[model samples]
Target chain A: MTKHFVSDTLVLLGRSLRHISRSPDTIITTAIMPIAFMLLFVYVFGGAIRTGSDRYVNYLLPGILLITVASGISYTAFRLFLDMKGGIFERFQSMPVARSSVLWAHVLTSLVANLISLVLVVLVALGMGFRSGAGVAQWLAVAGIMMLFTLALTWLAVIPGLTAKSVDGASAFSYPLIFLPFVSSAFVPTESMPGPVRAFAENQPVTSIANTIRDLFAQQQVGGDIWIALAWCVGLLVVAYGAAMAVYHRRTG
Target chain B: MSTDPQMTAERVRGPVIQVRGLAKAYKELHVLRGVDVEVARGSIFALLGSNGAGKTTVVRILSTLLKPDAGTATVNGFDVATQAARVRESISLTGQFAAVDEILSGRENLVLVARLRHLRDPGGIADELLARFALTDAGTRRVSTYSGGMRRRLDIAMSLIGDPPVIFLDEPTTGLDPQARLEVWQAVRELARQGTTVLLTTQYLDEAEQLADRIAILHQGRIIANGTLPELKRLLPPAKVEYVEKQPTLEDVFLAIVGDDGTDSTAGAASPAGTKNRGTR
Candidate 1:
């Protein structure tokens, strides 16, 4: 059964990757929004904002990367919605393949696609004078955190994907996710905000993740924020995974 | 009930799909009220019904896609609710809609199913199925580009990848053109000829008449009638003799408009005048 799960997931993942390859536009479209936000923030508002940091782009890149993942995962929800509406899910369910592999394939595809989009955003950041002297270990940490964040969000996306009545509803859940970065220290310092706004800006998962990635990029020694970020990622992943599996079993059964 | 020798022989050979007092309800609405069906092996069994007659619910339960709220169903001697994996291994379903991935090429879709079924040489199996379905010309094209007929054919080809003994086709030709419907019927017939047990659900009476060895009419969540064609006809009142001459059926006209051979020329020549006659019928 475990072997079937692995093989089926690989086959279905190949199908989804082929879909991405054929319509390279889904990735490009996902990357375009974050890249646009990055440019608008760095050039238009970079000099005006003060974080006591020399380059605003460096501070902004982490947040932009998070937004990229946020936007990219909407496509995951959208694609899964299409699969659910398309009757392909019914066909897959009727097959002898492991049932959970169907959802795993979509989740893993989201990870791969978002990783590529993150790489593209980082490349764009490098060209925009964003510099990091972080070692390979820090880079790996950044990648690991981003992947965990993506997995958590991707599984969260699967809920709406499975239950949404329309394509718009499936992808619409990401609006608040994209809006989250604006309230975080993505563009400005949380200390500069009002008391209530600062509380919100500092408490959400986005803020911790952005702060953690920002510190790693600057080669700064990390603090408890890394634990908070990991907790948020792992916590959300567990809850979302459980809820998504429950929904999937109820729907398919 | 009058029993045909052939039906008796089929019953003796044993049923491949069996349902006993199967029931499902959604809150206040009971969609299937104690439905029972026994489909013999190596024959085409048609469940005939109108819109919202719970045809799809039955198919879903039998294929292990949906669980019954009460009672049980078994496919190939395996219980759908408990031995679901075993049931799935012995059955394939082509749902009402074409279930092939629209982004993948027809060949890719087939290969994907073959590989998932753990078949040796998925590429070879895909090529053979494509050719068998006469989809070789369009095999390289994405399913999104194929016409409705080609998509349905590819869907069936994908279902057949594992050569499962029992196949469920749920309204397979629902939205197809007449010519395309004929092509699907021929395919279903071919499957039966190869000794595969087929359980198909449809709203069209003519489709049941054309393909089924046994037909069950489901009305308002109950199997109101179940028999072979002759047995079903026997349940109705005998026809009265009339002084009027018999007229050719609309199906005859339809066949004339779209040639019996199902080629494009006759369909192209079909006129609005002929269509108007068809609508009145």
Candidate 2:
């Protein structure tokens, strides 16, 4: 049974990936926005933004990575919405394959797609001079944070994908997610915000997550950001997972 | 994983689906009200209903996709609510549209589903299913390039990868030509013969007449009638049987009488048989 779940999930994941592979545009589309943002920021906004660092690209890359993931996940929701709308979900239900495998496959597909987009963004940042002296541990740490964040957001995406009445409803929910980084420490320091905004900027989950990634990339002391980031990621995962499961049960019940 | 026919045979004996007092409601809309249906070990049970009459809703509920507001149902003896994973494990579904990913080739789609079901040899299963569906030639072609019928066949084949017991087909062949519909019907029949209990929903009464052993008519969120074709015909107040040409078609008389709203003095004209129409809204 466990084998069935794993295998079925792999198959479905492949199916999802195939769709993504065919639409090379989706990956390219995902990479484009962040790449545009990265370049524009580095060349245009790079000098004006003060972070007490040698270059804004180094400080900004981490937050941009988070943005890439956030943007990439919207596609997850979009793909999931398409599948749901296409009646594939109904088709999978009749098979002897593990049911949860369907959702997990989509989740795994999101991870893979997001990873690719992240890599593309990172490569673009490198070309644009977003260098990091961090070693294997730091890279691994960055990857870990990105994956957890992806998982958390992916699960959250599941809710909208499953429940939305229309394709627009599903993908629209992700816009706020893409815009979230702007409010946090993604492009600018949270300390630079106005009094009321600063409190929210410092307290929001994305700030800690962005702070952790920035520190990890700069090879600076991560301090308590990593712990807070995990807590936030894990917490969102738990809540999103629980809510998604409940909604799934109610819908498929 | 187990390829033994005897094991497959044994798998067929168990009641693939069991339902009692199943009910579904959407805020003030009662979709399925106190519906009870039990599909025997390996038989085709068709639920006939109009567009909003809850055929897909019932199928969804049975396939472990939609939750019923009130009811007790099981797939392979697993409670749908509590044992949802098991129900999902035991069943497969094919809805209105071909759910195959257009970006992938038909073969890739099949293999993907195989891997998701945790099958041992995804490629082998994909090959067999392609052969069975006569899709081997088009296996490598991206689904986007395939015709509607091909996509539908691939979708059904995908559902069978794990050899699930209860398969829910919700208007599986909605937009197909006559030949394609025949192909799907042939597939459904073959599945029944192989001991798969199929719960099919169709707006096409001919499909129900041709495929179902036991038919349940759902109308206005409730079951108005349930029985065989003869039994359902018997319920229809002896509507003036017709003797047509030697090569008469079901469509000819169906259109003359059931299709029209009682202007022809021969249709028995009794308010258009409203209790059920299957998947039509």
Best by DockQ: 1
In candidate 1, position A13 carries an lDDT of 95
* Candidate of highest TM-score: 1
Alpha-carbon interface RMSD for all candidates, in angstroms: 0.8, 2.7
Runs of candidate 2 exceeding 4 Å displacement:
A1-5, A190-192, A224-226, B1-19, B37-43, B67-91, B116-120, B162-166, B192-197, B237-281
lDDT of 1 by residue, A1-253 (tens): 5569999999999999999999889999999999999889898988799988899998899999999999999988999999999999889889989899989999999999999999999999999999999999999999999999999999999999999999999999999999999998888989999999999999999989999999999999999999999999999999999999999989998
> What are the runs in model 1 whose C-alpha is more than 4 Å off?
B1-13, B236-248, B258-260, B263-281
Model 2 chain A weakest lDDT span, ten residues long: A90-99
| Poorest 10 consecutive residues by lDDT, candidate 2 chain B | B261-270
Q: What CA root-mean-square deviation does each model show from the true structure?
A: 5.6, 7.5
* Candidate 1 per-residue lDDT over residues B182-227, each given as its tens digit: 6677678767766778999998766787789999999889999999
Give the lDDT of residue A228 in candidate 1: 96
A68-145: candidate 2 lDDT, tens digit per residue: 887788787787788778877766665556668878988999999999989999998888888888999999999998
- Listed per model in order, the count of residue pairs whose N, CA or C atoms clash below 3 Å is 0, 29
TM-score of 1: 0.92
